[model samples]
Target: MGQESLQAFQHQVGDVLLRHRSFLDVSSKYQESNGRVNRAITKAVTECGCLRIEAGCQPFEEAIALSEMKNRFDTHLTGHLCDHCLDTVKEELGKNLFYMTALCNLLDIKVEEVIEKESKKLSTLGIFNLR
Candidate 1:
């Protein structure tokens, strides 16, 4: 299902990608989409007051197994996105994904293939897959 969705999205992007067919245009739009996503999140926190970020250092202990680290990690996010913020964030993220798919289309890369390759790496490396 995921692979099919990615392929469909790629095809859709290719069909409508008239202005940004060139690598330079698509890449620039992709970068801009990334910034827009960040701005959307920032607005949710700063302007909407729907979410808060209390980021800090993550506590780690050598005695704990690497597998346990996942349970101990702190996202540092407080509260949830209200309806308005949620919709805005979702729209921005959709744009980001569209551009990402556009990039993949330009490079002849399959989004699902990349996802599967990363999934395999994570499974193979398990707890050792840092970042």
Candidate 2:
């Protein structure tokens, strides 16, 4: 609700993302696009998160497996995934959710809060208005 909180959250998210994606921290230089790094983290979180939710995988492994699976898929795909693309296009929403969580963590927010807020906005304003 507060601008300061939002800004703080954004900063934390940026820091985490940069640290995770920074070429300096990486060994192989992945040769992937910025999109891939984003996607990797996102898919790892979502798919892995889901798996954990269903008791299919542990919280830690869920994300890691998703990243690994995505990499494999990306590598096997037609284009040279080895080129080190960001892989963002493969899972746009996945990346978005990661950023969202990063912001939530920064702002000390709960996913339930965001869901409720958006639900109220949608019901009152309508999706077309994006209100």
Candidate 3:
């Protein structure tokens, strides 16, 4: 597609992402419900094209669960569960944001505006603290 078409497509997709809240916010929702977490992970993996899924391997949900389990085990080995959890969450957030902003850049979109608007929406919902 031409740059103009790609930019428009990015804006449209960015709107949908904002409406669903940022991928990071959705990842946080895992504490509230695993279903939401799985769905969010699936969407992230599919949309961001970060993780490669083999044709006949485990599904996305299984892969996410396995990855989480590995993270938990690794963190537990460090003997600082609470700190590890917080750090892991932050890492996941950063990773998601990085991939998303990269995608926006590839599409010629302004990621900062999308992030600012989404952060405001989440703050108003009392779910995320940007400060």
- Stretches off by above 4 angstroms in model 2 are 1-90, 127-131
True-vs-predicted CA distance for residue 58, candidate 3, Å: 33
What do the candidate models score in CA lDDT, each in turn?
Answer: 0.91, 0.48, 0.49
Task: State the RMSD for candidate 1.
Answer: 1.2
| Of 2 and 3, the candidate ranking higher by lDDT | 3
lDDT of 1 by residue, 66-91 (tens): 88889999888899999999999899
- Greater lDDT among 1 and 3 belongs to 1
Runs with alpha carbons beyond 4 Å of true place in candidate 3: 1-81, 116-131
Every model's TM-score: 0.94, 0.31, 0.30
Q: Model 3, 17-125: lDDT tens per residue? A: 5443555554454333444444444544455444334443322354544325433332112122244344544566555554554456445657656766876887786
List the candidates ranked by lDDT, beginning with the highest.
Answer: 1, 3, 2
Worst 10-residue lDDT window for candidate 3 reads: 72-81
Per-residue CA lDDT of model 2 for 1-131, tens digit only, reads: 46566556556555666555533333223323345656554454455432111223323344554435533332212322221233433555445556555546545676556877987887877634421
Best by TM-score: 1
Clashes of 2: 12
